[model samples]
Target: MLLPFFQEDLVEAGCDEAGRGCLAGPVFAAAVILPKDFYHPLLNDSKQITEEQRNELRPVIEQRSLAFAVAQLDHKQIDKLNILKASFKAMHLAVKKLQAQPGLLLIDGNRFSPFKRVPHKCIVGGDGKYASIAAASVLAKTYRDDFMKELHNKYPRYNWAQNKGYATKEHQAALDKYGPCRYHRKTFRLDYSQPRLVTMTPSVNSLSLNSEVAVSAE
Candidate 1:
């Protein structure tokens, strides 16, 4: 079972991002402050679940969480600041939108750009270990997939509905056949021979929660 909170005395928000590895579409992030007692057997790392499961959990999380917000930075912003900073900026934007301010932030990844006065904890696989982080992951992934599906409607040739802009073999083949569209990331190495986004590491400022209980990286 996922831990409910890092500490007992403060409002905590779990944060995560989606679509960093995509060849196109905006990178999205979500900040979810779930109740201390929130629990769902299906909650886990977004990547570990199927599309159906993520979608199912999105509403459950929204209905149960204390406060939640989702935000994104598009291809232009990604190009201007680079994907890493854009991801951090997106996370910051989401955090700023929460109806209730969080005293502590549980960030899914190991690096973050820190949200103003709020402190944060970065877990290597936080979504699988923390209920709030898993909730954020569901929101981020489901919302990003929805955005990509909309983009797919206008640019069907890219098959974004299927690949969600990942560097998949089919996506590369499409880029080769029709070249890039207005939504494509011009700054990215868009070659078919290029590796997937998982091979990359984006640099950024680190964040950790105040009085956080540290768990070894998974």
Candidate 2:
């Protein structure tokens, strides 16, 4: 059972982000401000719910919430700033897009960068603890997943539709076979302690800068 709102006296918005751990695709965030009386038996953390349930809740949330907005930080930005900063940036962008100003923000995670001029509360697993935050989670996850499904058509090798750009074994296999696609983050260690395929030789430490220079000098 989730709490309806933080307090009846203050206007509040819930904040959450999705795809923070994906190897590809954008990180999406959502902010939802629901009425004080908002209630739904099915509402909960997005990860704990099925895709069909999330789809069912999305329209209801959008139609019933006082105000709601979703935003995304693309793959390039995610690589430039790193995942942590990119997640916070997406959340802040969503909050900025809200039609109504909220006095307080209840964020799903245990850490959050405060939105400008608005006070915030960081609740660990707030998505399951608060109705508004749960609603935000549903919106963020569903939207991000839909976006990844669309990207699957452009690059079918990675199987974005199945893994949704996560660091799965099949994804790593694809990376090993074809090298990384344009969406792959250069800064991230693609070979994260995973053994290379038996047929592929590992060149992770074969090249030296001075050796290359000496070869060029020859």
Candidate 3:
């Protein structure tokens, strides 16, 4: 069960970002100030929920929240500033767009770039524990997913509609075939330290191991 607010005494906005680990597309963030009494059984980390669930929740969150806003930083920005700073910038932009000015921020990660003079607290996996953060996570993930799906039409080889721009083997295979698109982060190392996004041959056994290893490493 997710709680409504991090603190009862102060106005608080929950913040989260999506697509931070993707090799392509924009990193999106959301800030949501929900009523202290808000409750929803379906709410959890965006990653734990399905697309239909997130789509269903998005409208409800927008209509019911005290205030909410979503923002994104594109691949060029992520490549230029690096994913961490770009994610922070997206969060900052989301917070700035909120209709309600929160007295405090509850960010859903272990690290955060402070937003203005507002105080903040970072809680790892906070989205699964807090209502506002979960809502923000849902919004950010759904919005970014929608963007990727749109991009997929223009670049069908990446299969972004299915993989959502993550460095999946199929996506890497596409990279091997067609090379990195303009949407890919050129600065990100496809092999973790190569400083280039290039095709890597996967051994038959490694093909099965890749998903497990990637998830664990992430």
In model 2, how large is the Cα lDDT of residue 155?
A: 78
What TM-score do all the candidates reach, one by one?
0.87, 0.86, 0.87
What is the lDDT, from 0 to 100, of the residue 113 in candidate 2? 83
Candidate 2 lDDT, tens digit per residue, 1-218? Answer: 99999877789999998999888777888999999999988899999999999999999999899999888877778888999998898888888888888999999878888788899999998998999999999998998788778767767887988898899999988887777766666667785333342233223222210111110000
Error of 2 at 183 (Å): 1.5
User: Residue 175: error of model 1 in Å?
Assistant: 0.6
Which 10-residue span in candidate 3 carries the lowest summed lDDT? 209-218
The residue ranges of model 3 lying beyond 4 angstroms of the native Cα positions read: 191-218
* lDDT for each candidate structure: 0.81, 0.81, 0.81
Q: How accurate locally is residue 54 in candidate 3, as Cα lDDT from 0 to 100?
A: 96
Name the TM-score of candidate 2. Answer: 0.86
lDDT of 3 by residue, 83-152 (tens): 9998888889888877778999999989998888999999999999999999999998987788788777
Given candidate 3, what's the lDDT at residue 165? 94
Worst 10 residues of 2 by lDDT: 209-218
How far residue 81's Cα lies from its native spot in candidate 3, in Å, is: 0.9
